[model samples]
Target chain A: MMTIERKPPLGKKVQLMATCLCDAFYDDAAVATVQVLEHLGLTVEFPQAQTCCGQPAFNAGDWAASRRVARHMVRTFKGELPVIVPSSSCAAMVFHGSLLAFEHEPDLPAVEQLARRTWELADFIVHGLGVTTWPGRFDAAIAFHRSCHTRGSNSAEAAATLMRSIPGVNLVEFGEAEQCCGFGGTFSVSFPHISEAMGRLKLQHLRAAQPQVLVGVDTSCLMHLSGLAEKEGQPVKHLHVVQVLRDALKNGGLL
Target chain B: MKFQPIDQFATTLAPEKRQSVYGGTKATHEKRTKLLAAQFAEPDHLRRLAGEIKQHAIENLDTLLPLAEERLKAGGAQVHWAVDAEAARRQVLAILQRRGATRLVKAKTMVSEEIELAPFLESHGIECLETDLGEFIIQIDHDHPSHIVRPIIHKNRREIAVSFEKNGLGAYNDEPEVITRRAREFMRKKYLAADVGMTGANFVVAESGRLVVVTNEGNSRFSLAATKCHIALVGIEKIVPRDRDLALFLNLLARSATAQQLTVYTEFIQGPKAAGQPDGPEEMHVIFVDNGRTEVLASECREILRCIRCGACMNVCPVYRQVSGHAYRSVYPGPVGAVLSPLLAGEHFLDKADLPKASSLCGACNEVCPVNIPISDLLLRLRDKGKREGAPSPGLPPMGPWALLASQPLVWKAALFCGRMLDHVPGALIPVPAFHAWTGCRTLPKWRGGEFRKWLRVRKK
Candidate 1:
């Protein structure tokens, strides 16, 4: 019910930057991404030529390689339609990280163009599409994990708003909810113990909340948290908000 | 001591130490947040002012330092320049030896810590007593301060009680007030008996040549007052342009440091005690220590000088919250330290090179920095600096080949197809070290549904 403007109503046409993580790790969330936009009357175009946002290279301090990879993404998603990303981190990479990587490259303008149009899906749904509530029911206690990239794109509140839209969902706020889940792309691999320790602390807070479902806009965070939970045999379910909302819409407000 | 990899330190030693430090910092961090919210009428405006003041000061140190020196000399205080830690130590040692001052009372100064002054003084038979409560506890316990502002931030009440008892301060309970009183009583004698006092300046005003020291307790004021000769050791970067600029930094300092409207004491000493002054030191000497600061000022990481040493960045850092300050093994720790320790160490930067990689690059440090230092960007610059200087590689999966594979469209699809095929294999059976590290905490979500590229191709047809 928010009255934010969308000059080109995102529903008519859009391109999906189904991040490499979604393509290889959580493709169902990628499908949910397409379905959710289609449900709202948006023509979601998946640029098959898109591969990676080059976040790994960028964060690894390989600016030259990051620029090379980001150039491919920029070249592939060249149309005028808004670039919708399911992952906040990838979306942020396109918007902020890619610009920095491509700052001195000849394709700087194209990268800047992509950066300007990039939108994280939760933010796109809530603000770009201006739909706060949907006919979806999820009868479960839920908590949203705000990833580090959420800060860059300012999507934490929008993601929270999307979760609150589900009619029967019981949203519980927890401590350290805004802290990083230690999935800093290569950070987890480089410093596994510290990364695991961080994830454990997050799990401690999430367990205290005792949510039946843990929701997040980014799979990377949920992936880290769920792995830790599985190791400890905690039966909490982890779902991307897109998948949860998509299921609710498909099942007629009952998920 | 040789350099140990930070990740290795975190894995081996940080787990046990992090929780206690986290608990102590979290309490202070919460208190600081609340106090800043209540006190600052417009915190954002104050932050911008503080940032601009620091930026201007660092950019014009050549003119400002001479101006400050002339004013200080005019006001009857001697000012000395030290180009490095050795020179800074020699200057302080000469001052102490001239006064025959063997016993010294001191306040907490990260600059002094930077120079490793306490041990240096101790080796020269100068019994330097740390009068600040947190510094007192750590000094008596033979431990380096784990935090910049909160010196004993790694210690809990029970640990302090044990330390106080062990140091013969008397049988003490775990109550903080009781331990503080014992420390105060113990430090009072040192302050009175000490021949010279040593403290670090929070800021030095260029216009009036005033050395400002901000403290929660009145330790700094007492240390500066009771002694005959007071030596103020300050980093060259601690200069502010005018006397009135104190109004901007003082507010930002307290708010960012302990989240207070104002610390209990904000003392501005103008060239020691002048003629006809009732109290304060007879002679004041301000030792301006360069100590690689000029080099940092010339580098890409110069904005790091804008830091007021508030320690807010550490208070909010998730990595600092988990690993504590000791894990950094640098004079400074957390985000600021990560950028600073390397840039300041010069040729030996790789000694603490792992510091830059310590962060998750979450930007929490930048978000809370009062001076608006784009610290995360500086951190990335250090990472690039390290790579260029031939520091050890990250020892993780190489991202270069991945980038190459991601750029070509045909190879990208085949790679995606392979990734989808590999998704069916249980993560446990993958036998990849990178996967092993990742799966330790989180289960990999299996790839489900069709690859987006194929779906897009079909839709196009």
Candidate 2:
């Protein structure tokens, strides 16, 4: 279990890509992401030009719609700055999807170059930038909700490693963390019963963990879980992992 | 009597509650899957074993087939090799003719459906009866199986009662136990009177040339035990190298199929009844049918052969829940069937190309697959193959404009602009059939009068 160390000389300029889910449901997560980046002495820039990485359309057999969205995103984010996304789903969409969509296209060489520069926030902080320090310390039990996009689709160990690094944060393990939260965008509404059923199952696991907060990178999953949690009146709160880190750094303890 | 296509019967029987029950049950299934996942934390090792065994079997199929035939023949069993479904039917009919099998009792077998055995036998004046309870209900109503495991999953109890009444079992109750008992009583006489018992083997151990059939109801045991002559119709792919392989398969088969630790009865038969046997079939025969399986094995689609017929993939599938299995119109349906049906049946049924597209590609099937087939990837490959080969495309509109627009950013932007401007277009100008299926379910989101890329460009400036 590797802990994220908060090293000195943390003041650095970084750009953040507010994932589509964060922008839509949990705008607080975006603010927290920026706050965390800045509190660590890093200047954060928000790229407003972003909309979506076009994953929903791509998964729904609408490859053309996905490509259109992918090209737009690639064109919008073309620069030398390291792009960080709060949500692993969107990050994966950018890192892996862009290359796939453009692999057979005539302009694939350029698209592949753009894809190489993208990163999920945890991966950026832990693997790329090598940041291991937080400004605050909180002594509360928390469980990391490994989103399916982050676990099966992306890499679970990477996110788990980043969380374990934060001090005083007791990360509890639950069953089937790699399974989908059933927030498959259109999948939720299309198959509402199955979607809700899957959501309830996830909620049950979260309750079983008895965590003070449920942390995940994807706000879509958080939103779905939050709705169910609110309905069930569960004590567990859903928050992005970055928010906890940001609170620890700024407040010097749990918020 | 031939088993009729159940799709029509189900549609008329319980059209109203069918969707809700299917949808509700799927939700329950997901919850069950979560619990099952917790109970079995490790990756299903049985799937890996089944995959390895199948791969070994396919590689040595040439040697194993003859070896199996020789062993069966030595044990007083006749072996018939059928090249295709037609030939398979002829061989079975010829055997029935030799034995004068007028009434036949059958255990659940997908191969029998593949060769359309019931109809062929019925047309030739032999009465075919389904012994499995689910198959019996479908048989009484002249319905094709809706799910491979549940058969009548689309039908509720009331609809089943009506079918039972229509078939002269009017005293039957709608409770599951009662209905099962009714089916058993009705089938009991047929099982005794039938001259030949027919079944499909789950796995044929090539080492001892033994056939294994697993079932919960014990109907299969009675079907084979009561009859004077027993005939087993098996696909060549069902052969495994050794006996111990059954332990690995038996572990996963029931659990994956119905979440049971083990099915109630697992019967292994090497040959017909030996001397002084209390009760068993007096004579035994095994028919090994290739029926395009060799072609499938030799082709790039060999992974499809790893299927154990557990039907877990179908139970959790979102697409199968919506359309049920009948829409695919094949003996097999859902993920495995989408790939295998086209290959086994030929390209003429390309109208079923929609079957492959029915999935959301959520990868649930792959997760629960006993053999770990990348069903979504295979389905995509089949779609691409269908398009390239100039299949009929099920009269669906061409995807040329969508494909072209997606490939080029400028063209897509223009299309988005036109779409946004004409957001209120009364669906008349949209001549594309591709959008029809989409719009039928939900309205396309309004484009907000400008493309995101164009907005980004202005903001950057």
lDDT of 2 by residue, B1-461 (tens): 11112222233434444574365447545654664576666645656667788888877999988888888877778888999999999988888899877998999999999999999899999999999888988888988887788888777788898888778886646887878777778888888888999999998888888889999988889888788888899999998888998887877777778777788999988898888879899888899888999888876668788788988788776556545777677889877888888878664646555456545455678778777776765675565555556554332333444445444545544554576444676765776543443343223433443333343355459
Best by lDDT: 1
Error of 2 at B441 (Å): 6.4
Off by over 4 Å in 2: A1-151, A154-255, B1-41, B276-278, B391-461
| Tens digit per residue, CA lDDT, model 1, B1-461 | 12126767766653346777787667767787677677767666777777888998999999999999999999888999999999999999999999888999988888899988989999999998888898888888888777898877777788889887887888968988898788888888888898998889999999999989999889988887789888999999999998888887887888788877788999888877777889888998999999999999999789999999999999988888877788788889989999999888988998877788887888777767888788887887787677667677554566778888999978877776676656677666786678777666566666642465555567679
Q: What are the per-residue Cα lDDT tens digits for candidate 2 across A92-195?
A: 66666555556578977656655666667776776666665544675668877777666344335666665676677788977546556665654444444445
lDDT of candidates 1 onward, in order? 0.82, 0.70
lDDT of 1 by residue, A19-62 (tens): 88787778778888988988988887777678889988787777
Residue A127 local lDDT, model 1: 79
Per-residue error for B391 in candidate 2, Å, reads 5.1
The structural similarity of chain B in model 2 to the true chain B, as TM-score, is 0.88
Q: Which of the CAPRI classes, incorrect, acceptable, medium or high, describes model 1?
A: medium
Q: TM-score for each prediction?
A: 0.92, 0.72
